[model samples]
Target: MSRALKATAIRLTSASALAVTVLTAVGAAPASASTLTDGISATARAENGNGACAHGGYVGGPNQSSSCYGGTTTAHAWCADFAGWVWARNGVTGLSTLDDRAASFMDYGKKYGTISNTPHVGDAVVYNYNGSDYADHVALVTAVSGGTVTITGGNQGARPGHVSTNATSSYSVGSLPWGQRISGYVSPAGSNTPSLPNPASLPAGTLVKSPNGPDVKVIINGAGIPVAASDVTPDKYDLSKIVLVDDTAFRALPSAPASGTVVHDQAGGANRYVVIDGTALLIGAEDWTAAGYNDRADMGVPTAWLQNAAQRQLTTGIVVMDQTGKDPKRYVMVDGAALYISGSEWTADEYNTQTLMGVPGEWLKAAAKKVPSTGTVLMDQSGTDPSRYVMLNGAAVHISAAEWTANGYDKRSLMGVPGGWLASTVSAQVSNGTIVKDASGANATVYVMAGGVAVPLSYADFTGFGYDKRPLEGAPGEWLVSAAAKAAPADGTMLLSPDSNTVWQVVGGKKKAMTADQFGEGKLSFNDVVGVPTAFTAKFPTV
Candidate 1:
């Protein structure tokens, strides 16, 4: 019977940190890995023409090294050393030689398991080809094919100590002369040896169960993952069982991540799909870029369109790309599923106006009834006027008497700003800090609390990911960056910075844009910033 052996190899090394990747195989007993060492020693012994020395023990010579093929009257071939190790593992004390090891395998008693469809654990995986007339490199079988014989190994590299998903064809086998002759196989003993565990089990051919996770998520590759509820497995469908999007009741699902979508390519091709609120938006393979998507500019029509459609269908937040200098704007598939136009220069107003709130204030008022209203309204500018503002508890706040707030304002707070204003915005019952941008990507702020009291932040030292110490300087009306937020340190010192991008944090000698994740070792991207361009320079007077 034709068998499919999905074996993996792993090489080990002692010099540097090892790169570790895991592979899982089901069923199938593995072949003995030590056989490779045995084969190496036996080959050396045969080449040296050492007679009884071929018994496979530590037969050393003039300048010997410790290996299964011990005699190093010549330069040591690390490959031979590996072969010797296998022999040593086999309990052959003195007959240490590659030739001896191979010869020993030829002997009746010590040979390992035989190779076949029913391969068991600890069998030597061998292959025959080329003029070499014998098996060369070897690895222990960890998993078998069909409930039995199969192949796989890792850690096979030039150093032989490296681990990999499969045997190294060049170094493992090709390193020796005549390394490619199939001479059957052998299994090793003693491994009640604990093996690595496989990852979560997946029933074969199962896909798209139900909604459960991120509101809109997608998976392009499912190699290591099991079939989950939030996926669409068109690739695995049989002709009779195929279901089209129109035929399914996907729209009836809630807009939760659990109802997210998964797309697969079964036309022996790669395609893209977007997951938006449980449904998929397929861009197909064409017209994606023609419709202004430059990310897949060069992809074939079918592939590109499939990806574009996915992006369009996403209901997730947008990710604006910077496309100032490039001919065409590019798109990034955020959350690994939805593609958004990327590389485009953005601004506070641009970012704000892009949201649903950016619609006309009249439109907002018309839809105001749709959103839920909390009874206790905290007015931020309450001190201004009871008719205009109302202080809920501590922070002075502003609330609109009308069902909806004015243009460019949210129903209960500022229109574009959600989570409320940083300072005047109440936290539980108290107000302590101001709103600010946390990073280059998004604007988020936090309020400072001390001794259980909301301590108002000031303009001295604000701590965050990136830092720009440049003071706010420019024509006032020209729009210097706004003060993002103010925070009073535990020491009573006030911290401050413009609301746009920079937050004061020190790295190496200079204070520049820095993120907490990066261990203050590298330079920030802004170091390359030339002066603001003449066109936009007026708008960013304080930058």
Candidate 2:
């Protein structure tokens, strides 16, 4: 609906969010990113229409020059070429050697460590729809809708090879079954802007001097951020917009940013100051901040606690967002039915304190114990501890731990299963083991192991599914047959009786009874069923 609502609902993905942020920035490119464009002026290039690239023209056989960008030829896929030309025309630096292949943008971004999922307004959207590690197409990120990124590209639709605004591709930001057709994003090549964020995102009582012509002023306050309250009037900017915090005792207001200048605070960490365009009053609570949580209004709606916080904070440990209550609490996330605890932040001292918070740590350990002791053991290569090793469409990738809490983080992608479902192998402790049948011969008892732990099957299910059962007065402990243990057992398995004389072996993938004559005295001592060996000839001495 509204632009502010849309922005608040979702965030722009990082074309380069992994790089550690600088304390002070005037919107300059990160150390890990090269400039692609400083944003286009459209000079004579209209936003859309037949004359999209009017001022630019083509000459020789469509080289990396400005001609190929808006050239009259559609000989090759020039999405990347047009993007490069746009960046070059806008006076961005460091892209003189940009290639025509759509994947080269990724190479440039990786070289500078800026290739990320977050897309800016002028980045190249790389795609891998064909399953290639290399991107198949490239487009420009022109807008972000909710959690979807919309971008424009070349060689698409009827206007082959023109800079068009409507040419778009979408990638999901904060959703499950997460991710877009997008491979990643590449920033523009150069131009060292001071890395300043929009001055409007600062807290109340922050004094800001508007940019005087093109001159910008950057000042780091004590908090390391360029935050201040103003009561100053100069050649430019209205000081009235600055929040006033007058002590009143001295009858004076706070000082203003020097020279009415737009400032970049060096105190704030990289990516520490994201623009929150929401209407709710969320404080920067430490736990919520670490978990990348949105603040709750002092007594605001509780469900509003961690909207879109699933991915980023999910990296390090188990992050359980107890969305069950009105105000959802946070907990460590775990696999196996998505176990979640209900609470806020925890520190190193409170580590392993699930019991303290009324969580059954023992229960989680049960599942974790079954998984590979270390995720590395499950990985093709384990260089270090990663955020999570995702198995997507059967392809496993190790996401970096450094970005455990970055935006667009989806766990099911890493888990390789749909939400609310877990990957598990239900195995009976004992297979092809001894079983006691009823006197009426209508039912059988299935023991879990050698020690006779009865197979714990749901009775309604045990009888409803037609496992061996009888019309007894009470449920029998002598489980002769398994109901749940062999729902869809693999071919060639064994089913035997506790008597040790009656033997049944799977033949040609079907269970067949062994002749009693075959297991008398010196006959075959063992019979194989479903890949398990059962001692049928040896008399099972009954107590």
Best by lDDT: 2
Per-residue accuracy of model 2 over 1-543 as CA lDDT, tens digit each: 111211211111223222221111123353232222324323113334332234444211133543334344443555566566555544545664456666666656655555555666666666542222244456666655566555555544443335455423345322211122455666655553344344434443344443211112222221112222221222222445543221121111222321112121222221222212111112232323343333421111112111232112222233333221322433443333323322222333242453321112322233333322112112211212333443221122234443333322342234322111122211222222333233233444332222112333344434432344422211122222333334333433434544454455444434466676665467554533221123321222321
The models' CA-based lDDT, in order, is 0.28, 0.35
> Clash number for model 2?
47
Cα error of candidate 1 at position 435, Å: 3.3
Candidate 1 lDDT over 1-543, as tens digits, reads 001111111111212432221112223333343433333223322233222122343333222343323432212222223333333433433332133122232221132222232234444444331112222234333443343332332213343122223322222221221233333344433322222112112222322221111122111222122222223334333333322211012223222222223343333355443333433434333423432333521211122224344344333244322222222332222222212222222232243245321111221222222221222233212222233333322332333344223222233342122222323233322222322222222222222322112222233333342223332211111010222222212222112234444333322222334344543348333332222112221222231
Deviating ranges (above 4 Å) for candidate 1: 1-118, 129-134, 142-182, 189-431, 437-543
Per-candidate TM vs. native? Answer: 0.24, 0.26
| lDDT, model 1 | 0.28
lDDT accuracy of residue 456 in candidate 2: 35
CA shift of 231, model 2, Å: 38
In candidate 2, residue 265 scores what lDDT?
21
Tell me the deviation in Å of residue 37 in model 1.
15
